[model samples]
Target chain A: MRGIFSDGPRTALTAFYWAFLLYLLLPLTLMMAMSFKDASFVAFPIGNWTLDWYGKVMQDKQFLDACLYSVMIAAASMVAATTLGTWIAMLIVAEGIRGRMIIFALACLPAVVPGMISAISLRIFISTIDMPTGTAAIILGHTVHAVPFVVVMALTRLRSMPGNLVDAARDLGADNVVAFFRVTLPYLGPALLGGMIFCVLLSIDDFVRTFFLGGYRPTLPMLIFAKVQGGMSPEINAMATIVLVVTAAVGLYAEYMTRRARTR
Target chain B: MEPVVQFDQINKSYGKHVAVDNLNLSIEGGKFVTLLGPSGCGKSTSLRMLGGFETPTSGRILLSGKDVTRVPPNKRNVNIVFQDYALFPHMNVAKNIAFGLELKGLDNQRIHRRVSELLELVQLQDYAHRLPAELSGGQRQRVALMRALAPDPDVLLLDEPLSALDAKLRQQMQIELKAIQEKTGKTFMFVTHDQEEALTMSDTIVVMNKGRIEQMGDPDTLYGRPGSVFVANFIGETNLLRSTVLGVEGDTASLNWNGITITANQGGLTPKPGEHLYVVLRPESIHCSVTEPATGNRIKGKIRQRVFKGNHTSLSVDVGDGTLLNALVHPSDVAQLSGEDIWVGWKAETSTVIPDRQAHN
Candidate 1:
């Protein structure tokens, strides 16, 4: 059994998989290397490694303020997206709402349609109403991209729920409200949590939408974009590496959670 | 006493296709009744309606003389043990059983006592701390049963609850379930496609076909004297031959089979002369012999095949024109057959007459 599980052919395939991983992570690896450069500019090879860039990043007030604004926007969007996504998923899947296929298609549009289109539309709408396009507008725009993921994940979990679990709960003297909390909510916890994590990851790194809607103040991603425009510096590389590391951790955890939930 | 559940003229339809058509049934309290049928025959639908998971398109359902047709499942007096158990995946066995009691807002001590008693009833006392996924299939089934029984609901509706188990475990649980039903004295409204399961556990068996009740009776009455061709075919293995009615004499009818006329009882049914008729004979009722039988409808035919069952040998004799007369002879008696050709016979009292006065699509 062990031989059949990971034979020579399978080991070869695993090698290929690691190669693909290397291809994906090569740019981030370069950025991490450049972050420790003693040189003023972010580039490849040589030079002495130092923490001076990290020191500069820590002391930059504007960059730190942008980081705070990005955190606020991402946190607010994560909460809103998770709540709406979970409830809307339940409404479509469990509530037996009519026209479900249409609703499902519509719910998935924000995810499938181009993010640039959504950003442009949201920016237009906000400016048309004379609303400020700084943190609030950026948060709204990011939610549009993040919510579709949450909705899809929650719906996937809810759809695979055993048919009679809710029925059994009700039969056991639980009303619909209690049944949801007792049976359905427990099954949905991992999926909803994964969805929230994805939302956080996407919101924190979101560049397209935040670029469009950041009126006077810049988010972390917008600040990184401005730094790149001014030519790559060690401080910019340091900040990018930090963001990359956090997002990668979140993304991996979310993947693991959703997969485990599915298997169970 | 009022019936525990009464479905009056219930009809359920999915789009244009009827699921349960004009179903009327009343289940007595403290009796184990099974709704047995083929797939898509509305047995599960009927059970669902009683459990309030399904609302009939028309008609009312009364629980203990109180109408509950439009009530949600939680408000109804019944609970269900689903086919796959439907045990809460997250909760341990004890918590699963206590859920209903918790919903009723019972004190913790009372809930624990009720859960413990239910576990004991299901003979799963040691499995209280195990989650549903941790237990085996039969153990999961017991936990599911205990969960439904915890609240002591008036009616316990089980929809093919033993279907997920292996054959041996299913048989074991059948006896266990019947014993539990008797001990609790709760109305057990079970639904299953397995006739043997229904016969083993039910005090009353309601056989359904094509979204309608074909026959409802005790196992003895249903197997010994099936009312219609559908019921006779569904309940057990039986030889059904379409025949031409020669005439009717009292409660018995004479039908012409493959070049012979046989008399069969109408089984308390009266039909018009110009109607379709069928002869229903259980395989065991037909006795095979090398020599001619002393009396009754005896036909000579050559043996086509022999199935050597452990307890008995089943032989099918071809009586010409594509008609095969099957007989289940005892293993000891099968040795006495002398040649390929033999006599297949049954008493007139054993043959059942299924008459259809109206044509059906």
Candidate 2:
């Protein structure tokens, strides 16, 4: 296995992989670097590094309020999405219900469809019903958008699990309900955890759906978009840097957990 | 003894294909019965139906005297050991065995005691803390058995439980399983595709073919008097010779081969003239001698090939009618006849005649 790296073509391929990774990370890296600039403007490769911009962002009341609102909405949306998604996945995989394929396809439809279409359609429907598009509306939109991903990930895990284990439990004198709680649920722990993490990240990072639904209360993404239109400020860069770092840390941790699970 | 479980007029079908048709069987309490068959012969399907994992399309199943046809598997007083063992990967040996007792709401002290007893019974007391993946194939099989038997079900169903082990281990486990079954005195219904496993382990064997029971009897009766040509061919090695029934006199029947006539045991069946039949002769039944025998049912043939098989020699002889017959002679008998014209003779009572069916293409 180590000998394969000695060849020129293999070396070139390895370099290409690194290059692709860097390309994907470039924008986030730049945003973080510019956040430390002494200058008031968000500029890359600044002459001086300072913490003044981060302090300014911390003190900004609008940014602080938006961050708080976004956190609450995202948390609420994730809890709703994960619960509903896990229920749907368990039913489809374990129960073998009629029209399961149609239901599964419908559950996953939101993931592949354009976010703008979903956002605008939700906006129109909510407006007709006179529902206020504030924190609650944005939370609802995020939940709708993030649920399909949770379902897909959880359902794949549930489907791949050996059904023989469940049957074995029943044969060992467990009723259907007891078997599901004792055997099936425990086996799904890691997958369900991973799905929950993914749902949280998705709900927090949503921009298009939140944009249409946020009428009075602004989420972090909407706040950042407004700052970008007002000529990129160093405060905006500082906030971006924090979001990027947190998301990257969570993403890496999730990846490590999933890889370890795969190896086992 | 009365049967502990009974399947009466059971029929199961999937779509248009019949998986098991009118399967009726009774398993006596504390007796070991084996359902033996080739693949797709419905042996596993029948066991699944009995385990309540499957329901018959039309029929009733009785446990002792109560009808349990519609009862779910978890409610039925039966347990199954799957071919793959199906041990809980996340749980250790002790937890796996205790799971059934825990489900029944047994006291913690009783569950622990029973689990320890089962662990000792399977001879894996030291491996109680080890996961299923850490154990060897045979050890996993034992653990699976302990898990199913821990509940003290009225019946135990083993589905090809030893098929996953190596040949040597399989043979060892066969004896261990028999010993365990005898010690527990629990009704056991094991299913296997291996003929030798069925013969060596079962008190009663039910041979199945194409979703139907071909024959069911003790090992000796199944081997000596198979009910059909299928049962005879499937049970053990036997040479079948095409012949026509000449007549039946008392307990023996005279049959005419291609160019010769011989007498065979009637076996309670009357044969008419011109009826094509098959004469089954075990290789060991035929005796080979250098000198042509003047008496008994004898045939002269030149030895075509002689292969040594450690304790015995297998001789194939051509008896002038383009038919090759095989005879098993011991090494001592081989010294008297080697690659020469010889006489083959068998007692009339040792051979069985069956109605000849269409030959396979």
Candidate 3:
């Protein structure tokens, strides 16, 4: 018993780190437990345990449709953000020092501001332009908001690479396009996957932005919010548990990809 | 034949700091030429311009009698072996060598053959499937060389390619590089700061100083007849004697070194009387003796220190007036000499006079 905790010195920083982790996880753990309770309402101490809510969520058309829309939006956002972000990162890093500073500042404006204000501003801009609000609009919003993260990730990886690798590629008879695809892109694989996973998560879990930008077709989080208006229900817990499982699966896949890219 | 590469007054600058200034240099065809200089002397900058990795701020570049000043690196017919052996960390040895061939749109069979041939050329045929990270430093260097060479470029530029090797391995690679140059007979443009490596490998040496070419000649000519005090000091160990020129004869310059009259070969540098100059003498050329009976170019001093080298002995003599003379003599000669008075002398043909320039400071 002593040997297990004795491995670490139990310093203040380590204690604080575990404490913050517990604070983040306790609420989610309680929600997951309530999903399995066979009660009419949600509670921590359960008299009966069953998977009735989870079974009901699977058959509910509204919940299934919301889940389908969320998956589509998140997938679309992942592709768009990762592609555009990688290109922008390369362009910014290759620019002169002053140019890099200005461009980076402009790109990070959304991230520095509060998400609600940015989302509402984006909604106003879109409505003013007469563009329809739908899953596509939500995907666009998520992509714009997630681009800064992807750019930062790609920039970090590109910066860590040896400066002469690109030059060496050109010297070996590869043109600019070929050199980038062959040398630069390979090094950015792990970073791109990481950015892509984060974008997927952001698009799925985003609530305020989806409420402002999404059209008649609602996403899973919007549906969950609507269901929670009256009171807490086990069906909401069921949907949350499903989303959690999906997120964990995607995260595991991303970890596998990052490890594979690192080996090559 | 036209020279393989030419830089016509090429100038490269970063903002206000000029990296290369009006560099007018031409590399002759099918010769091993070395651009020898210390770091920040613009040798690497000149090489980079030739490789088209960096554009000249002004002036033009030519290759095969055609202007290629604005051409990108891949569009040029030259390849460079980078200093740190920039092999793609993700590729195997075979793939690395085949990179250029594939870029040229060659078919798979041809690329495979070319990769195999280059692997055998660099003697790494057994390690074709191994990645660059798995190879040793010297092995990776050879892979970089073979990868650049597989393109069959007109000129191969190497930027300090052997600097990352151990001393003995560096020496071995120097001989192999020279042998490869001979076998292929490509116009090789090499860069290095090690004077001994330059002398050992280059058929023509271009000594650079502060963004300008100081001297260009064969190794023997560059060593024996340096044009300026900088060249003389940069190429090898030398004993510099400050003197005022009394006058110039046809091929000989007469100077007074602290009231001791000395005549040396001018080597085409003409200086008028009462002008400051320097007499450049090699340490090995000056023989040391105990007695004062010397024939030519002799100086008297007391032996301050004696060092026994492998094949020669070096003596440090204080010849008064805060001037110290370094002389290399036979190792057997130090057996009979002690802290007594000695004489240092060299033949007239081995020493030359160069005009003194204070701008070097």
Candidate 4:
């Protein structure tokens, strides 16, 4: 047993880790490589490579409009989700709150439920309420999907926070409203920022909900899906590559910001 | 002048358990008072009630002769240096100190001036720009103190603020805290479980037990003349010798021990003839000798154990019937008591008598 648990590296674990990494990166690498292919079709064994597909993707008015449209929806949903989620998180973590466990479970239910199921239910609910299917419906749907992530992140931060901070604020002559804005909200800054960014990323890539709720105007994912039905092309790969790079960069920046805030 | 703070028949109960029971206390201005007790002794609860953190079930709390029972904590002119310091992590030391002043609607210039002056109070002027997370423990403590003092509150409440520091730091902070109290001349209501800390810092100490005040007086009075067995044991190390009172003189009582007759002070307690009592004998008051001295109360016993405590040697002498009386002696006295038999003695004025309630049953 000591020999098996020795300080030396385990070859089997190393092999399995590399295999997992390769499996995860292989498809992403292919898609990126195909974006640079000169051929119009997205097939292997490309004879030539060029930047023409990227140039065309950049010039496409429909792609640009779709990008802007998706961003606006993500922003709207993020704002609503963050505000509502932070309030719910605070309610759950507060003292003398009855049935906290049940409240937390319900708050986090959207995150655990299947996206397809949530999308279908949201569609039916919106129709029942006589809400038109457009930016409002898509934002409503995205906000519901985004809320649980915000709640979970904000809840984790709130639990680790010392209760004394608020007490100290009150002792120093701050009323409830002032104390929340001055002390509690500032303390929850990093968590809320991370959660908002996560909401944006989640809303941007959410296909099922947008597909179900969207009307005439198509988002980036919807536009990409429409283009894919026509034919798989290097232009589509270029569009996907741009989105992948941008989202990955945003996610990384959020991670860096949270880490910096934590250390500070 | 009236008292700075007063608690009138306060009682705080949580569900079925009473935390503080009918507590009435008046704290004078410019005095450092400490509520000292073990955990669950209601010391903290009483302080919280005074600070407007906890409302009493039935009572009124007055601040400088104003009824503040229903007032919120922010409305009260009382500030607390919380046990954890509770400095805002996002705010710098200067900003943390300026928080209360800003809320008072002080202009930026005065707030800055006041914050810097407070920083100089703890000699942390250079650390004004530093965040709380960047500060050392003692520095953070000073910042917390300065923050509480910034608003010139009528009363300052400290809840075991020094308990988190190391031994040396705690001792240093104790002196600093007392000095700050003297300098500011603010009524300080400190709550702590450390008896030594209370004795060192408090102008007046209120000893609490079981949700009630056990005794309240100056430190010397509480230590030298404890009213009950709990106060006697809790304030300092002492041995309680169960005895029956044979006779009583003015301010003195003759007690009959297991087989020895001893005389002790009444300690303001009146007892009649044939009454059961316990004589509270401080260990430091007892002297150990090889032979019985010609004066004071003397008892013969065998030396059961000896512990060398650097400054003095602590001896546990078994005085028959399984009763071990502890006595502190000089290291030189231990060599002379090598024999089996030893005489432990203390003056009659040094020991006090208390009625043993179990005898009534």
Candidate 5:
């Protein structure tokens, strides 16, 4: 009792950190656990465990199509966001342009703006252009929302890098392009990888952006949102479980790679 | 000798602040020239201009008699080892050395050979596989040097390359750098604030002050014949006494410093009587004795304090007019004068007179 009370504030802070962690992970953990429930309905404290919901979700044609469309759209968005973000970061940092801070702030504004606001604005803007509202619209919205984050992350990494390395390479007979490729790009490797991974996950996890823009085809997030609104189901639990597992794996991999890079 | 690099009235300014002002200099081929100055004196700026990292605002830079003012750094046949060494963190020592060769599109075998040879030259043959973080500061500096020299550039620019090393390592590297420059015979333009480093390593030293060249000459000439009071005070420790020229006799001049009369050898500059002047005396040149020497300017003073250095002892002698003159005596001779009345004197040749036209008041 004395030990517990003597370290009261520190113990409280440690408890608070663990509580925050639990709060963050609770919904996903509950969804994963419910996915293995034998019952048809999703609920707490499963009496039995089974893979029937996983089988059902896999067998459903609509779910399968939505899964395919989500994968394709997310992959396309990830590629576009990463490429555009990396180019913009390099331009702002390495090119020594005027008003760099302003440009950087503008580039990062999309990520800080509310996703629903961005989605609605983008939806109205794209509608005036008479563009389709399916995978293309979803991809556009996700890319816009995710690219800013990628740019910010990439720019932070690029700015921390020693500019003298590039200058050294130039002094060593390397042309601008050669120096960038041989020196700058290689040094940006881990940051680029981490940015790409985060961009992909952000694209996949985004629901508000996909909701307004996804026309006929449903992204995984949109489908999940719809399923959750219609009431809990074992199939939705199974899908959420898969997403949680994949996101955790990717996050762990990114953390590992970034740490390894820092050691180097 | 023909000039390998020349700056013709080069001037650089940012907005209204002048960094290098109408600077003109020429470097002969196969000579080691050091730009020596204190911080903010524009020596580094001059080196950067030579390396094509900076462009003169209103003048031209020439290399081997060809105009290269607008040439890019990569196109210029000059390489620079930055002050921080700037080794690629991702690359191993061998790869770092070979980076320049690879940029030149050199063949693989030749790149390998050159890298191995340079590794041997810098005495880092066994550490080729280690990353820069794994190596010590001096080893990283060597790798940077090897990388800069791998392309066999016509000129090498070193921006205080040894400034980052420890004292012992810096001393060792000073010798190593001189040896390397001699072997390669590349026109080396180095910049440093260290007086000893500049004097020990440079074939010629260009002293700069306030964005302009103060003087440029061989180390001996620069040390012996400083053109201005700033140069005289900067290059070595000198006691610059404010004096007034009383009269001139042939090449020697009689000067009065606060009513004390002294004589010094006059260079070509002749000052009229009552003109303000400075009598520059090196500490080692001033001798302290219990009795005045037979023939030279002598001043009676009392020892204010004594500092015991390793090989010599320095004494602060107060010559009664709110002025303290420093005299260095050999440790063997220190026993003769400690807190005692003594006569401090220097030969006329050992002292030079600098007119107070732009001298610090």
Candidate 6:
């Protein structure tokens, strides 16, 4: 009875939880608040607020072009990574396939490698291969990094999937191709969606790899980095706050979808 | 007519361990044939082979007199109901049922008609729009059955489909499954380790042991006249009395048990004189009495123990010479037995004898 409802430990745990949440959100909250500051420079003080900075960031042609370019690259890399990752996951889960553990480890290596090390290595690789630094190179680098996340997520879901579903389909007169498309693909839908969204987020937030593999055209992260080099401004904060909110919403939706799939 | 399915001298071995060894069986069409054995005895393996999921190691499988040893599952005219009731989670009951029909290039109208008819047969018409996860266990099982039956394959394979249900629901499904089989008149190859399930639903039961067929017969024959000691022990509770055959007369053999000479049916075995054999005596066949009445074979023994089993009382009688025989008595008749000493008797025709094969193997 004493252990059931101990108020002393409960109070301590509640205080710790709130402290952790505050620590995590305080920086992001400050950045978002600064986006509404009326002053041209970013500072911590009680000042007048306006939406002029957001409007300016939204109207900047260079910022809009960088955002569009980053979106196109993310879209391309998401498709590539999802396809390759899902295939590798299926191969790992398939029966009679030897060296599956080795394959899975190799496929997931990129996710563990340091971002700077991977970026430097990719820069060297593109130079050695006589390929120029551009959108294609950036897409390739992003695909390599994002593939591991997709593989890990899809493999986890695939492991939980019942083996009999495919067998039942084949027994009901479906060929291997048809069975995979009709049964296996639909079963992997939620995991693939989550993985693809994660890939998009990973690509959009990546800077080290893009820094090493950029052409004349700048991406959103590169553009923001270039702008930050000048000085900290509410306009830059406004742009970052927009990216942050959109990415957070997308991440939440992915979590919601996969969680719903799991419950179903 | 040719057999619907035949395993011609099939052998399946995974490296050193043989899952199936030299199995030869022919299944008749429109009959409920069951492969009954313990797990790893190759009952499910045999059903999977017939379903074209597993290939035999050294022999051929013929379906309707056509060799299908190399045909894949999709090419074979067979469908299976998996134990887990592997219904498509993404599709509703009606869509799941129409999957096979759609693959077969059936028009939407025909597929829709077939799906509705199957749902109606299983009394799941209202559940046609529900997902597999939304249905009860019994309802999901019915959906799986209807899904496999949608295409109307030549044979239906059930790999312990009813094992997942609760005891009472399993019993109800057993009767429903038999009724469905009779109404469809389709060739069904079922596999189960539960002998009662095999006995209740199968027209022919194949008992397997150590990856080999021990016996295959109708339920009545397998129960009343089991060909082997394993079959006798596996099918139901039975007491084996080890004895030596004195002589064979007609279809009966005279066995010398302790000092009492008992005549028993030979059970298709012509044992030579002085041959060791076991008399398979079902507990229900032995009647317990206080007085040694005019009977065929009587053994005077003490009642070691009595267990009241609702309808009948099971008594363990200690016959002389370190022998304990079990007998079933009615509760009322058991109440009359006041003394520990009693006489247990059974007719000569009721007990069957099989030669002891333990030492030879």
- Candidate 6: residue pairs that collide: none
TM-scores for all predictions: 0.88, 0.90, 0.90, 0.96, 0.93, 0.97
Write out the backbone clash pairs for model 4.
Answer: none
- Candidate 2 lDDT over B1-361, as tens digits, reads 6689998999999999898989999888999999999999889998998888988999999998789999988888899999999998778999999998988889999999999999999889999999888899999999999999999989999999999999999999999999999999998999998999999999999999998998899998888877778888898888787788889988888988876989888766788887887888888889889876776689989899988899998999888865888899998778879557899988888888876656322
Tens digits of lDDT, candidate 6, B58-158: 89999999999889999988999999998999999999999999999999999999998999999998999998999999999999999998899888999
- Model 1 vs. true fold: TM: 0.88
Q: How much does candidate 6 score in TM-score?
A: 0.97
What TM-score does each model's chain B reach against the true chain B?
0.95, 0.95, 0.95, 0.97, 0.96, 0.97
lDDT of 3 at A104: 79
Give candidate 3 misplaced runs (Cα > 4 Å): A1-18, A47-53, A96-98, A252-256, A259-264, B12-18, B245-255, B266-276, B306-313, B329-332, B358-361
Better of 2 and 3 by lDDT: 3
Ranking by DockQ: 6, 4, 5, 1, 2, 3
lDDT of 1 by residue, A83-201 (tens): 88887788788565799888778877889778789889988999899999787888788777887888888888888789888888888788878888888989998888898888888
Descending-TM-score candidate ranking: 6, 4, 5, 2, 3, 1
How many backbone clashes are present in model 5? Answer: 0
lDDT by residue for model 3 (B1-361), tens: 7888999998889998888888998888889999999998999999998899888999999988889899999899899999998889888999888988898889999999988988887799999999998898889988999998998998999999999999999999999899989988898999999999999999999999888899999999999998888889999999888899998888888889988887888877887899888999889888777776447778888888777778988878887775788888887777767757888777776789886888334
Off by over 4 Å in 1: A1-26, A39-45, A59-64, A94-99, A112-117, A215-217, A226-231, B241-266, B269-279, B295-299, B319-323, B352-361
Q: What is the lDDT of residue B156 in candidate 1?
A: 90
TM-score of chain A of each: 0.87, 0.87, 0.89, 0.95, 0.91, 0.94
Q: Tens-digit lDDT track for model 2 on A112-165?
A: 889999999999988999999877888788888888888888887788778789
Tens digits of lDDT, candidate 4, A1-264? 567558357867887899999999999999999999988778889889899999999999999999999999999999999999999999998889999999888988999899999999998999999998999999999998889899999999998899889989998899999999999999999999999999999999999999999998999999999999999999999999999999999999999999999889
**Alpha-carbon interface RMSD for all candidates, in angstroms:** 1.1, 1.2, 1.3, 0.6, 0.9, 0.6
Tell me the deviation in Å of residue A81 in model 6.
0.3
State residue B193's C-alpha deviation in candidate 5, in Å.
1.8
Q: Which stretches in model 2 have alpha-carbon errors above 4 Å?
A: A1-19, A52-68, A94-98, B247-250, B270-276, B293-295, B305-313, B331-337, B355-361
After TM-score superposition, the amount by which residue A24's alpha carbon in candidate 5 deviates from its true location, in angstroms, is 3.6
Model 6, range A15-132, lDDT digits (tens) per residue?
A: 8999999999999999999999988877879389899999999899999999999999999999999999999999998889999989999998999999999999999999999999
